[model samples]
Target: MSKPLGKILSEGKTKKVRETENSDVALLEFKDSITVLDGEKMDVLRGKAVINAHISAYFLEILEKKGVPTHYIEFVEPNMMKVKNLEMLPVEIVCRNIAAGHLVKNYPIKEGTLLNPPVVEFYLKDDARHDPMLNEDHFLILGLASRGEVKKIKEITLKTNRILSDALKAKGLTLVDFKIEVGRGTDGKIYVGDEINGDSMRIWEVGTDKILDKDVYRKGGTMEQVLNTYIQLYQKLLGKMPPIRGTKNE
Candidate 1:
């Protein structure tokens, strides 16, 4: 099940990629495996890949309808997505609506503090360096992105945060913070790329800090609890249970 040379692309903790039947498209095969703390903590959660693929597709479609450009093409399988092949930008755009994670650990911010206007941060996408935080000047110094490009990335990220936060609020969940990657397509336009699932976001039950996202896996939560929370979220947003991989129907 391996793709030919030049057809196979990059691999990450939870995803693999190969060329699709369409030359301009690629298939992202999500895996059941999960990684946390910079891949130091890892495990296999049955059915997770399927759930994430479906959830990512759901959000991408909604964002597309809202005039946000993304690389998403379609869900080709329960655990695979067909997307436009992109020259990914080497940065991770993060928008935080609440003080948590590194925000609290690195800064003096108190946990649960509401960021009235969500804070946007950028990190150079270098795993070996643990993805060091970057500023606009850093982007210029490293030749990673132009100031204009950085500005646009921030704008799009903030808009996405609003859209996702509102969507989750309607489902009785809160979007604590999320990270997104962007890329340039063959069309010569920058679009949001990569998947947006529980792994990329921190979600909590409305009005309470009941973790419902990957933070569970990071914090030693059980796989059963993690999968159940993901299922509940999908059911709330999509009005149906996601088909689990390895099942007859899936």
Candidate 2:
């Protein structure tokens, strides 16, 4: 097995870290714990780490097969992956395949509006300000990204969404909405960062408007149960067994 290189630099809610061989790289440990309601509550959901790793690994594998540029290298275990430590852009790329939630609430669109060409929105990643929406000009004015970089990010984001959405649909899951974060590596190559989980997606029941994904949490579902449902749905879609992990509290 390839040994890790450096010391862990930072950690996030979904992933932990250890150093990798590369100075600008690390091993990301995707924990079984989950947070929701904007990190207001958390739970150590049983088997979550394993399920998350499997889901992400499977998705990234598909993306790579479909020729998307990402930071995935190799899986270390049920809970870990080898990846580059990237300098993240303080923005979130939101891609909507079908309209619901805030989109329906904020716009005059119907609930199940299907966007022919996926709509992409950018948001400032400032939690304190609730991640306010921004435009391409905001990126230039804030000096957060060059015009060229912004264009590149947009192009890649759209391509990523298109490919992933099609792939998921083939597996009977509608890729309603999802978020992406981009970052720069030591060589200045832009790659995707962060875990793409149920929290980052807005999946819905294929035939009904019944919601799945993070909307469950928003709709008052318990953290543990909601995340488990997500894992189960993902596993069903991928036609895989749910890897068993931590024991559930009786």
Candidate 3:
């Protein structure tokens, strides 16, 4: 049986975390609201949440199967899932592969240039501050995470990148770059938390560099175009396209 959803614990642009009867468990509900420019630009894409729930579940499950610890517990049909109620950090870990997005904008590195060894960066999850990048010393000085925790987090993150990169490559997609959130669980262990869907990652088609992820929306693609890309990517990667519960596909 499933636990009853409780009051809102927190909400972000595309998801909401709800409390549950079990203190260590929480309900994560996906929101159809999609935003770009750090929530400045937004729109409601019906059924977006439902499909991303599936996308995130699919990827996180892969990580779990490969022995990666995660807060994802179980996926609930439609729009919600159960997850470990962790003491989530206000940080985001970004791993870059081919240069694009901010990498190109912030640095002289040309877009699409391959990053040797793949740069992994830490960032403070502050929207108002534009989620400023943090160095290892910054992490320790600001008490964002302990030294050991930071080391472990980076190890896990890099390993996750390898696991996911290979997985997507097998499907003819390139893992351009992605960000993930980590939290300390009640078990005193760090875990990969938050959703790992197209929203959190840049996935491009290999040879043609066709957009197969949220860049479709981020770069000004229309709702129908973006949704179509998400749907097609799901079916392409997972090989099945069930009718999404909240969209016309249903």
Candidate 4:
């Protein structure tokens, strides 16, 4: 169903908006759009809408099964889901299982190294500000969350990372890293909100160096191929027939 104009709420890179029947809930229409390098106006990957919808639905279902709090209700369409509206926290939680990118650039660390306990990093959610990294002390200093809340966030985030990593590994994809955002409800309980699609994760091929994330688009790779890979992975997880592979744009 198209979003009723009176109920339209917020819209992001790959999703549209509409208020749901619940006053505090909204309907999210995931678009077939792809962005890279943190929305730096990168090329839009074709077939992204279908791929991301499948991926997000699968992960949300997984979180529901694991007893974690989330905002998702049910998929209303091939590219839409209903969820609770939340006062989104102004931080992006990134948990890295392998050393890569900024970690190597900012610290004296070797690339492809393993983080025994994994590394949980936070950044301000301000897109214009370039999402600066933050520590626990920084989180507290900014009053973004209380000490107890921060602890709870860490616990949930790490748990999510571990579970998704193992899950992707089972499908021949290594979860090198991923980003998450949490929001608090009126009762002060944190629910995993926002989209949890393939766009928010770094999925790598197990044996080879094939990357299935938006990185493929950032590097000017085959957008259609990359998006199809993500959709294929999601289809595999959901026990559904995958979409026919489309010809790559080269």
The candidate maximizing TM-score is 3
Residue 187's lDDT within candidate 4 is: 78
lDDT, candidate 3, 140-248, per-residue tens? 8988788899999999999999999999999999999999999999888999999898888999888899988889998899899998988878887878774675444
TM-scores of the candidates in the order shown: 0.93, 0.88, 0.95, 0.88
Give the top-scoring candidate (lDDT): 3
What is the per-residue lDDT of model 2 for residues 1-250, given as tens digits with 9 covering 90 to 100? 8655445567777778777657666788877667764567766666677777767777777777887777788777667788777888989999888887778989999978889888889999876787899888899899889888888888988888887777767866688988989999888977877767676887766676556576776777876767667766666566756657432421
Full candidate order by lDDT, most accurate first: 3, 1, 4, 2
Clashes of each: 0, 5, 0, 1
lDDT digits (tens) for residues 1-250 of candidate 1: 9554336677888998887667888888889998987788888889998889999998999899888899998887658888998989888899999999999999999999999889999998877899999999999999888888888888889889989998899889899999999998897778999999899999989877688788877887788887887777777778777787544445
Worst 10 residues of 4 by lDDT: 241-250
- Give the poorly placed runs of model 4, Cα more than 4 Å off: 1-6, 239-250
Candidate 3 off by > 4 Å? 1-4, 245-249
Model 3 clashing residue pairs (backbone): none
Better of 1 and 2 by TM-score: 1
Candidate 2: segments with Cα more than 4 A from true spot: 1-7, 246-250
Clashing pairs in 2: 5-20, 5-21, 6-19, 6-20, 32-49
lDDT of 4 by residue, 1-250 (tens): 8654435687787778787667887777877677756687655555566667767878988988887788888877556787887777899999988887678879998978889899999899877777888888887889899888889998999889878887787878788888889999877888888778667877778888577676666666675567666755665566564443453321
Judging by TM-score, tell me the better candidate of 3 and 4. 3
- Write down the lDDT that model 1 would get: 0.87
**Cα lDDT over the full model 4:** 0.77
